[model samples]
Target: MFSFLDKFSSPVKAMLILTFFGIIGSALVAVSYTVTKAQIAANERAVLTHHLAVLVPDNLHDNDLLSDSLQVTDAQALGIAEPVTVYRARYQGLPVAIILNVVAPDGYSGKIYLLVAIAYDGTLLGVRVVSHQETPGLGDGIEERHSNWILSFAGKSLINPLENDWKVKRDGGVFDQFSGATITPRAVVKAVHHALQYYWEQRERLFL
Candidate 1:
């Protein structure tokens, strides 16, 4: 008994129309998310793999470093405000090394983020400064290509460097500091030492 326009003008009919569209919109959003979720995860994994390879090297690890990641929350030990990710690398089902995400909070201008790779036997694989706000020419030498400064830490461990000799050259340690930049190197050295201390403490749980 109702006209088409009359039905549309009814409150119940209007409400029904709105509800129908809302359900359709929500279904579309769900479908879109389902379709894109795997790709997003893959992209993130690829990035993490590349970083792990840079610090630990591809041939050295047979297991998936991205899948073997753990989060540790020790602000004082890591020098960061938030938890840091640790990537474990293994060879032939045995632990080879671990890459620790570290932050040097006392850099010359600001914080310096680093990736430190250390073998299970306590050998230093490498130290990479991922991000820093240090001086362009001087403090930036902490970067591998900037100079051999970063490479100097490659073979060093707590035993090799000796705990008391972990400071910059100006502080009478074995590592060098840029001519005009001591604070940056000092902060990095301290952070590396702290990372070594942490690994020594958590080696058992970490390898498990």
Candidate 2:
């Protein structure tokens, strides 16, 4: 009973109606947010799992990669200014590989985020471009969807490339640079190389 509204002036009644609707709307919004939050989180987790799987295959790791993560920060080596998450994968309680969220700050357009998976013994399992703003059709070739260039990092290591051959082919290394777009690939190559070096320096601590 809203019969009490009969005693109020028309304007007051209108105001009261609006206020009631406002409260209801607010409540509905809160309920919707509460209801969708978990689903949104689950969707995000699913997407992350897919990305992680791309670098560290599901068959290679038995442990929960999402739960087994470490925070690492090495501006010079990892090219990140702040702490970044490193997802660790294990099989039968033994280290399988680590997926690092690395940043290449010198991309042609801006910074490039990468998912680099390195095995326990410093071998690279895979590398994926998570995000980047490189020029379309050129620098964007660093993306696996754009080109298979990123896949070249698989199975590589600091020693496999001899440390001196980590740059793009244009720079006298083995990696290839995109046609007419060298800066983007160069940045990614450097970032991946640094990520490997960081892994080499912190391999023991990374597993623990």
Candidate 3:
């Protein structure tokens, strides 16, 4: 006494229903992501633009970040594995500052990424750590807050690294070291020293 409708009520029908719902759900997710992608991209661009502004002087105007020439190979030659971007911050079409990426591969835990902007004569306009893996509380002073140690890096030059003049005070350098964290400042000093050298060596390529 099999009923014809019993076949339609079987697991196959349930599977079909489930499959249909899955397809619809996936399509909805895909559409939602596609629609929101532009907004997400715009937000990311805004963040980058803001960070770039911190490097440029307030008096300057007409800054175009994208127009600045970028070179990946030159960065690689200098031991930077990641793509490094260079921005020419101009005041009335005259170069005023140079914003570039610096990589500190010898960080205590891992690599530390930095954005450094310097005037043509080598005055450090600003230095911001874009990314890092140092100890959460102990080594994070490199940022703008916990400690103003990073500020000391400004105005230093490659001509006088003063390794004796560029170390954490604990190590007898002019810069202050974290009370409980030595490696962090040590790594930062080395990175800044290397970055200054790299900047001088690449000035020709960067300016043009």
Candidate 4:
């Protein structure tokens, strides 16, 4: 390799070596991505299935939540700038619940992702924080692992809390906030409420 390079100018030799390595690097990257693509997708599906099970549960629905999904787009109600996936759970051909992948754009640090499960008749089956960047000990309470606060949304409906009382206690609502954190819970509450409203507006279309 050095003997061949010595025949050419130093700059040209270096350029050829750099170009050769670049192509090799690019090929390796492409191969790696192709090899891992399927595994990545499978892992994502597994995580999503786990989240859905936590919200809808195994006994609640007989249908496959992963397969029965629809895309929904509602910037205002769902707070989604782009269309998001909604997983539908059914039992014996009847709608059991619909899980919306909602984004709370007003989270304290940034947008908070949520999986909101609403029963066929607008009752909230459960709500889970899929991901968020809220503060560690405070705002992170919205997570089920961090605190049971997320479970409070289960069995609740828009009418149960009343439209006016959908905010955190600091905001004069029924829900409680962390000792030093309020924005995280408030944003989640607002997002879940919007998800319920979105389901109400699209209930008929969703099941179809």
What does candidate 2's lDDT look like per residue over 24-87, in tens digits? 9999999999889989888867877888988888899899898999898888888878999999
Model 2 lDDT, residue 70, Cα: 82
Q: Can you rank all candidates by TM-score, best first?
A: 4, 2, 3, 1
> What C-alpha RMSD separates each model from the true structure?
5.3, 2.6, 4.2, 2.0
Q: How far out, in Å, is residue 97 in model 1?
A: 0.6
Give all TM-scores, in the order shown. Answer: 0.77, 0.83, 0.80, 0.90
lDDT of 3 by residue, 12-56 (tens): 677777877899999999999988998888886776677778667
* Tens-digit lDDT track of model 4 for 1-208: 7787889998999999999899999999999998899889888778888988888889988888878998878899888789999899898999888999999999999999989999999999999887889999989999888899999999899899999999989999999999988899999999999999989989989999
- The per-prediction tally of clashing pairs is 0, 0, 2, 0
Comparing 2 and 4 by lDDT, which wins?
Answer: 4
lDDT of the structure predicted as candidate 4: 0.91
Worst 10 residues of 3 by lDDT: 71-80
Local accuracy by lDDT, each model: 0.87, 0.90, 0.73, 0.91
Taking the tens digit of each residue's C-alpha lDDT, what string does model 1 give over 1-208? 2354364657877777778789999999999998799888888667556767887878888888878889988898799979889999998989999999999999999999988999998888888887788889999999877888888888899898898899887899988888988999999999999999999998989888
Candidate 2: 10-residue stretch with minimal lDDT: 40-49
